[model samples]
Target: MARIKVRARAVDMLGRQQIAGIPTAVHELFKNAHDAYADNVRVDYFRADELFILRDDGIGMTLEDFEGRWLTLGTESKVGANDPGKRVWTGPRKATVRAITGEKGIGRLAIAAIGPQVLALTRSIRPEGLGSLVVSLIQWGLFEVPGLDLEAIEVPVVELQGDALPDLEVVTGLADRIRANISHLGDQIPADMRQRLLSELDMADFDPEAIYSQIDGPKLAGDNFGTHFFIRPTNPVLADDIEQSDDAGSEATPLEKMLLGFGNTMMPQSGEPPISAQFWDHREDGISRDLIGGAAFFTPAEFDSADHHIEGEFDEFGQFTGSVSVYGQPARQHTIVWPDSSGRPTECGPFRLRFAYLQGLLKDSRVPPDEWARLSGKLNKIGGLYVYRDNIRILPYGNSDFDFVGIERRRTKSAQDWFFSYRRIFGAVELTHARNSNLVEKAGREGFRANRAYREMTSMLENFFERLAIDFFRPTSQFGSEFNSMKAEINQEAKLLAKRATKTKERQGEFKTELDTFFTSIEKGHPTREAERIRAMTEERLSAVATIKSPEAAADALLNAEADARRAVAALEKSITVIKC
Candidate 1:
């Protein structure tokens, strides 16, 4: 036999070794489906095997696009920068459009972890003025895979064969196996199962290609062209004895696999109010902000309970472990005050932690209200959570320490209270995640620019603020006594001055006469006397202005001179119908 050798394959983003087990890859597929404007997608199980199926009423794909869209890995249909001004894909009405999320494009290789089967079918969907083939799209053939002994076997990186779609029979058998696989999963399904599946299975509500129902308001909208996903584990399609099972675990079907879904759409921007918080005089005593537009789901038949995690599902690195942030406000813009090498804040540099308040908004089981209030002062805010929305994206600008928002002052001043409150989060997630100054700088610039362009930059900062407030800050001790002293100082100043007033009638009368003479002279073209009087008056007021030390002094002089004038207005207000609390 001739000697042959092969080089080792490198790991891409969707490599099986990169993800914990199976769920991560499925997540990629669902992401793709959303980009395609799929209304509802289901990964069903039958015959103890997994059958991955995603259907969208959006523009269907043709054979030409199968290689470009489905067959390609690391594709993102929604990868462009977010825009509030451009309402094109803001809600959900594109069938053939794509999104940007996955970077490696290696999700194809991950299919091995699901099963040995794969297929994709597609058709073209055109816009109203355009013809049928404007943009080619594809429907993935019912993808199926055989059980493989993956325990000791490292996944070999390989590409899918040819540009053809899978057969319809494969899809039918896959659907059948979806049912069979569910039975195989039996009781195990309930542990990882979620209640959200039943609704996701209702495909009509989720097509991404069709524009959805209505536009609610600014910072809120209704999903029209729907795109969503539902998935679950399956029973044993392979003979139990012949199965390539791992000592640490046995095989599971795709339908039996954990599921996640996402969707996007455009809404009429008519009701959207201009974005700003200066008008928010006080807290909003409402139920929710209704900002985020997606859901996390587990089949009721699978998990039975809504527990947030499944233990053994992650790799030893604990990367695939579940984490969720519910309640409070949605992700907010981050602040990176530092400039890049060019010394511009939005250009490049290290990272900076953006800060915001988002507590009492989330309905999660977590949060301690009293403690959060205490943490608020440290936050220099109230009733808000501080967290990072997206992983800070860093752009290299030489090797210098160009950290913009990574300073301890930034974290301590805006986020310290919250960070400390959640200090022990699985050890030190806050400290580790926020330490990347390089990333923060780039992301902040991007966000600042996006904000100006009316973009909703993604970040996990709300949850970050909440966790920090809960674990890091003491309920009554986020800040020092000095902060309290400042509040007291303001109150003292207000009280001292409220009872006093300004304006002495005699002095006022003289000043008024001088002003009238000066203005009258100017109109009569007599500048000399007017100019002199103005000079004298200005010279006299200087002394008064200098002698004034505090508002109280100003108040005292005016009150003594005009005490009688105050009574009229005060009495009228007091006599009014009601006072709002």
Candidate 2:
């Protein structure tokens, strides 16, 4: 019989290559904390030192649990594989139980995607008493060497008594081991390549003890047992992943963009445990600042300024029961029953959705001009429909560049009639792993897999928008009323102008008769030089008035004015008809 063997490179492939980017790597860590019933998690980055640390105040692991579960790849402990009825309690008190967000058990490997080496320290709180602290040093570079089996790469694990964390000497010893592991590969590779890899370690100035003192001394004081990670990114690309801006024009770093929605993704329902997350950036000047300080992507003002709003939940029957508010009107109960082609209960399950339609134009909004301008600027940068599962956001959905629901493509078909565009609406589709197990996220954390459940969810969203367009957006729009008012005003002005033109023609006739009488009187009275000049000028004016009163010219002018007004009204009517169709 032949047995299967795993290579050392499998760790590199699963950790560094499986995860998509830095943001996803951080998200996996946060999910792990959530599953442990953590109330708070803090992420810190030291730009000058290229050091990254994450601390969570959760129920940490014991040395036994660390060895049996944490070190075992693809562990099924969280999934209850052996005992189907087993329930995992989240907090140390066992008061709250949460469905585990992770099932594949490969999330621990995501740490390698951010850095080449990691130091993990954890202290467990069991029902009997506090357990000893478990320390582990993971050298990811060891897995990269050729001709090495997975079991041959040894990870150093230590058990310390009574919250005794690693000191400077312990950290230096681990660093030396990493250097030795890389140098040991010299027999398999060239000598110059070995020197280059050794130089990249830069371990002379590596200091984890100072970082621990700066963080743990004040935070983890007095009976605080949790997990902390100290990571040193030796690769320049990995360091730039956290510090550089996501776009050329953006001032916000990639880390800042990811943390902006921390703890703000969903409003907690009754009995739901709340989690808080924060990010601290240590600048080169030795000053630290919180990147996301209670800032929300959407403000109340933006919600209030929305022209249309729909919020409700979809039942398992593929029916939506909710209220729809249009243009500041009172919200009314609205329901939509989406017909499923499969003729079965929806596989997507039950979820809640909240959407706000913004016109993104000042003239269309009732908000104050200054406030609207500021909100518009924000909407332009962070406008899209977002997805959150168990109050945690799924990435690449709400980003400015991602059009997950196909709104942009739909708008291209009927751009004018379709009132909703990707940038003009803000939405959130809330899901839970317990109810929406079929709508699974991809391994890379980019988006949901293109499964039947995902397709059904997106199709339902599109149907909702279509219903909104036909029932509310088109009917309540100001275009029809404003166009009608304009047409009426133009017709009235045209009639008044024709009346004035006719009155002017009658006045010219009367004035001509009076002037002719005056000229005759001047000719009979005297033949002085001034009188002769006045009579000649009066005759010239009277002759011009006679030409103005000609039947052909007067009739032509009235007819032309009426024709122009009729054409204008007809054009407006045609436009309205097209819009309605």
Candidate 3:
């Protein structure tokens, strides 16, 4: 029997309603551990490799918790609650206990997602006398008996097996200790599977002196707080095979580089927290810095049945971002905040669309419903196949990490895919409804409101990233430098852009005037002024102007056509004059 050690029975997934892999089921457990005050957590795999364990030193389980709550499936996590988003795990008198982040009982299913069977063993470490509580695996597996109804509707679950897996008590060895304590298990992870657990426990402890000695000759004290996820796995049945970094010569991991770049960026104040960055560009000129926020899942997919929202005011720094997801289509699925036996969530809405696309829009002008509908129409057809759409035409953006958006394959893998899965996924479309809505009378009708909204969002995102970058890169300075005026540079560029926009508007107006004259000037013009060929006329005029990138040039082409029409009229006038003579 392959023996792997893991903290088990931390919670029961059967108690909650889910049918999936262990990772999906245990999402809640890890969430609680992270949210809890606990700094460390351990996930252990035992004898069968499938026997899972999750242990956290935050706080142990209590009698009421074990019997009534922890074992209860689908508990009401937030009711009349402040921050109904989460639960509060405060030790009596706040005696330095770990904070907990779990809310939904469904998190127990995350374990099921990770593997087939789990042996739960949890205890609370709080005020002196909150005696350790013991709950059995069988008890958890049977927490929800068949045919029980929740307040919402009939519980869809058909059967709840309390004794879902074999029960065993294991003690001793590297795997066992790690199964017990969450902290030590982190470093012990190996790059690829096939190694024994106890064989590498010693490698987990910090090698501070060795690490510090290599940092620019000697390490600075401040950067000591960081977590490292080593890429190594030994023992196939007991461990997982993971991709390893062969760059032993480098002192830092690639993930660390991505993070450090954010910290040392200019205008760092803007890159903190919800503001953490995705990328930074600090040109060696040491004068300019630009940082972009974390890459949010920009889901452009929408369906006719899909109803999603984009709402959030830009913070003080002017960064606006979020998602647009759609699930009403035949293919897409909705995310379930609360699990149901059907494995599909009815409450969490069917579709979402996220984008910084709105960032540019936020700065543009308020977008009208018509324009949004137009974009949604073109975009919804993309499904999992495409990402970017420009000017109502589907644009093939690069593929997403999760392979969800496939350019070549175009297949929807599953409801839960790692490449596209987000712990917190939200998309925003700037609900820009028309500002200066009446300006359409002067500017022309078809695109005024829509154009303004587009310009606004585009402008906001550009400056937003610029500001964030400046803040992030502010810390790293030359030995001597003088205060520079970046805003002045920005102002100058803005003026040029405005001038160009005005010219674009003028050219569009003139293009309409020229096109009408062009067809009239043709001797072969339809003898009748019929309305039937309006569409064809438009096609011909547009085709003529297609090669012209400059709006001004297009307008000139139309004007030339008008000039010909006048000449035709003049020739007829000249003929009558000669006849009278």
Candidate 4:
């Protein structure tokens, strides 16, 4: 019998290289928490220990679940939730939220991408309260053993009461003895190293008696069960030490970068619970940062605007159903910004789009002209069309780089018609699982796949923006006072461009007529092939100019064909003068 073997490095490749980044890997874990029906998920970065502790107040997995489902790759537990025919819900969470954010089972392997050592402790909630907590220590290195099949590797699992800490007694005892002995050998060690060693003492911070006394520690959280993922990073480095250099060789890890970028945004502020505390609600604050000071509301009707809205309702399984509101003043014209013959037929359904014209405009543009640089920085840091699935965000979707809906791409193609790009427009398309089941996420957790449903979703969104730009964002007499200065500036710029084009056209026309006349006179006098070819070419150039449909096309013709016509006229005049002499 032939044996097929896979190396452990493959797991690492699948986890790290396959996913976008560490931040995305963490986001996948967050999705897993969401799928697990966790109302509150806490992500803690232990700066000292070089560890990430992601705990959630959700229905945790049982021993069987840990081994059979979690350990097993490509499990179908989450896939069941994708089916609209059946509703997937956990114990008490059923009353609140029934949808799952995860489907592909490979998300669990994201832990391997982030770290090699995973100490996953979870407790399933019983009807009474806390249940038996299961601890699974996964050393990813074991999978990398030579000549070993992935299936052969077994991660050990230990079950304990909700209050029981993993290796608490032994670790605490050792920590205390080590702490006591540290003072004796302190003179031999450097002061900084000694302090570092003292700070690095593990399991000594927690009070053993206090932890043991509680029948249900923070481990069993929320209304039901909870899960804790204690991961020691493979590339462990002190957070502070990472900032010592700015070179590529000394750059921070993805997790470190994410922490530096969004830590302040996601971290709980004043009067909030600590990382160890349970069920801290950061949704409001989080939304504010996530949206970059943009509004987080459902309908534009709430704003009491007379703006127009496009509503879509689909009865098909997993179709989009929601209203897209154009926030700016609706104009009479509805222009299509699509490239010629490249526009796709788009149907609307399954999602909500809100074109927030001035949502973050005030916040971003409030600064003085001199402070425009600061404002630009802020906008770059915190602007984009956000995609919210249900209420939560999908990682890297509406980020600075992930212009998934191709707003900038469209803007580049149709700059005149595009009101604002992904950077300037504070817009969002919200979707619910019940309504948007067909919009499935890619297994690699990048973003939604470009399926027919997603393509339709994107088309509908593009149309919404198009409507806003052509119909609403356009200058109007109704809001003349508001747009008067902008209109004046635009008019002045346009007139200058038009004047330049007119001068160029007159020059080209004069030259073209002269060139054509010269060629025609030559042909009539002594018909030559060169004269016919020159006349033909000149006529072709004139035809090109006449056929110019848009301002862009006209400018292009003036720049190229008009310049060539002038040169031809100059050369023809010189030849005629020479012949006369």
Candidate 5:
């Protein structure tokens, strides 16, 4: 029988295919750290030295574990075979409580994907006053040899003895270099820490330098066991791939630097405003410039509870549980135009949506105009619909480029009615490892396969957003209808006033003609009292006609003029009021 063999070229191909980009490869390392149950993971990119370091205080692996499990592909540590062909839970707790994220045992390959060479230095205590450490060097360039079998390649591993090991001295210098590279971590590094390294540093008893003198100094002190992965990419350009702002003149806050560097979803042109303690809630105040138009927006309180917090759970087919909190002023009305199979117009999702009015505004913000735009950019990068399995974000699921629920595509189809955009939402879906095992991720770390459970979950979310759109736009639609009705009524009354003014002018015109005829008849005659009185009444009537034509003139003006004309006629009946012709 012939045995199947994997070529060295296949390993290189898998690395390229699995790790999408530099950012994705970095995210994979974060998952590995989380799986190791590390409370804090430190990632440092030393551009000056073209080095990338990821250090975590997790349970470091021994030489046996490294060769047997870590090096083996498709290791079954996370899940085990139930009988023969099927796999079941293996209780993924090594030395700590954590939901294991590294199931396929290929997370280590991500380091190779980022660079050609990698150094993994891991240390773990075995017994009282005894510990073990190993330094493994993986040079990927050797694997590139054509037609080389993967089984033939061997990574160089060196085991270190107690304090005497020379590797300890090199590690000490490397630790110092890492510390020197970073000026200050600010809130990221605890301020009260005695030693420079927050968790690893112990200056209480041993001299800070003594830790470097012996392997037991800081490296082996108090469960500080971990792996420090150092990789220096062959390409010099890869070192500076992660750009930094070069404005030496202006001091940038930690938050600003993060937004500028990682805000992938930010609009290209809307320049982020300068970070200040004052303009935190600028979104509300800015949009409120037009009060009437802005009133179209609303808060979750209008539709749900006053708390503005929403929570739900699902254990039907797969276990899903999460909560959402909404904040900010409110957003403009977004209508749902997408027609559902049920013949009803769909909105956003079957999952509850708690929209932050100003894109990603949270509750804690009050006076200081929160950088709403920056916050939006940050949310856009993280994803509006965040999906987390075992509290770890699944790749390509909630990422900016990945539209898991087809929100972007639907929005593009008809943006007017289907106005839901990933940028405008800050949402999260939490799934446990045991309950959501059915949401299996692809080997490439792209995302969960489109299985039945995954499809149902996405469909439910889509329906939720759709329903929200319908409910949200209902009141605004009614308000618009009422406004149009009132406008029509006002217009009708204005038209009636114009018609009455027109009729008054016509009567005045007829009276003017009669007066002119009377005057013409008396042109060649002598004085006549009755004729003079008629002329006087006609002049008074003409004055009323002018007032009638001037619609804006007081309504009383027409009435007063008519009364005077009648009196003049009565006077003519009695005797003469003006000289007759």
Candidate 6:
């Protein structure tokens, strides 16, 4: 009997090809740290050296655990046979247990997306005492070699004495093994490619002294048990992932945007422990900043400028119980029945939705013009309903290009009736790993898979938006019935004013002509100087009343005013008709 075997290239398929990009790769690592109960994770990039390092003070893995779990593909340690009771605990402290964010064992392979080579170091804490530091160097390029079997690769794992980390000699030895593999594949590959591979494996030039100096630093000294990954010659694509800022005209990298919805940045949840993340630039003239400490995109002014605020949770029965607050109006509690055609309990678990809606141009916003411009720019950049699971943001949801909730599609269908746009919403749909197990994300981190649960969830969300439109947006909109009434009033007033102006012009012309005749007759009679002076005075007094140069000009002015008024009335009527239809 023949048995199936996975080629060495399968690792590449599960890693670099599977993950979305650099940001998502970093996100996966962050999730891993979170599952390990890390309170903080610091990612540092050395621009000059093209090196990336991520350090976390989590409960690190022992040698046996690393071999059994980290090295094993598709391990079920986190899944625990799909039983929630047996799922991995986030921390050793049973008092505060967080649902594990990482279930697929291949998440660790995401490191391959970052770079070709990675040096992983970890020290575990045991019930007896501190475990020996375990270190492994993985050359992902080896996995990509054609015709190579998965078992053909040899990854050396070294356990250092006490709490000691691996030294340069140890790293050099591991790198030598990578060089040996490349040398073995020399005849099968091009000379130039082989030379390039050999050049990249120049571990003699690699110096991690700066990185080791941080081992006993403030962040890792106290715990002395955590995980550290040092990756060299990071993927060049990362350098291009720059976020152009509209406000300050500055630039931010993917690392800066990583912690946007982490911890209490968006909305704080009770009993959830705060996780701090930072990005350090170790290059000369580089600036190190706290990733999660930046101000939120939606400020108080932004929230206040919103036309409507909707926040609530869906129960297991698919009933939404929440409050809708139209700006300047008292909050009203409302319950919306889910439009479930299945007539059964939803497979999509209950999730919370919080969103602030803003109308285009912010015509009713009280914020100052300059401030509003800045806020509008932010909305255009970061707007869209974001989905968060356990306070961690799911990618492609809040992105300006990603229309995960079909908002843009709905708007395109009935543009006039669909008052909502993806650009006008600052929202979040919160879910938990345990409850939203069925709503699985795609392997590429693009979005949720189009499963029944996902369909139900999106259907519910769309229904809620429809209800919001009917209950709040349509009634308070400036393009509603009240607007039509105001336009009608203005049109009537304009028509009356135009008629009165025309009549007044005629009367003035008549008076001017009579005065001109009287003045001319007096001048022809050759009256005394006093009579001439009196006539001139009367003419001057009457001259002020003659506004229109001619009857035709006066008629043209009235015609234009009437035409404008008529056009305005027609537009208003058409709009009203559409709304009614």
TM-score of each: 0.32, 0.75, 0.29, 0.58, 0.55, 0.75
Model 1 Cα lDDT, one tens digit per residue, 182-265: 345354334333122222222212121211121121110111222212122221332232222463322222212222112211
lDDT of 3 by residue, 1-581 (tens): 99743222333324333423222233345445433433434333322212233445445455455555654655664322224234455544353322222344555443433432223434444545434323332212222222222221111111112212112222122234443432333333342311332333332332323432422211113211111111112123222211114644222222221122211111112222111222222233433222222222122232222232222334322333332222111222212121112343221112212332211121221233455554433232212212111111011121122222221221134321121211111222212111112212111111223354334433443343233223221333221011112223334556666788888878876665555555454445443232224445555666787788899999987776556555655654443331110
Candidate 2: residue pairs that collide: none
lDDT of each: 0.30, 0.69, 0.31, 0.53, 0.49, 0.70
Q: In model 2, which regions exceed 4 Å deviation?
A: 81-86, 93-95, 178-186, 189-209, 216-221, 238-253, 262-273, 299-305, 475-581
Rank ordering of all candidates by lDDT, starting from the highest: 6, 2, 4, 5, 3, 1
Better of 3 and 6 by TM-score: 6
The numbered model that scores best in lDDT is 6
Residue-wise lDDT of candidate 6 within 1-581, one digit each (tens)?
99999988898898888987887888888778877778878788777778888988788899998999998898777774335566444444432466676687646899998888788888876566567778888888777777778877777788887645566888888788777866766675457756766666774346455467753321333348888888887887766554344555333345444445554354433344446666565544665544444554454446666666778998775779998766535677888888784566678888998887765653444344577677677777667788888777777677666777788888898865666888878878889877788988888777789999999888888887776666555646432444334435545766676799898888888767766665675666633454445546545534532466787876676666556556655653443331110
Clashes of each: 135, 0, 105, 4, 24, 0
- TM-score between model 6 and native: 0.75
lDDT of 2 at 130: 78
Query: Model 6 clash pairs?
Result: none
Error of 6 at 29 (Å): 0.6
Winner on TM-score (3 vs 4): 4
RMSD of 4: 22.2
Q: Per-residue alpha-carbon lDDT of model 2 for 54-126, expressed as tens digits?
A: 8888888998888899888877777752233565655665645555677776568888877777888888776
What is residue 44's positional error in candidate 5, in angstroms? 1.6
Number of the candidate with higher lDDT, 3 or 5: 5
Candidate 1: list runs displaced more than 4 Å.
Answer: 1-20, 45-52, 67-99, 128-343, 346-419, 423-581
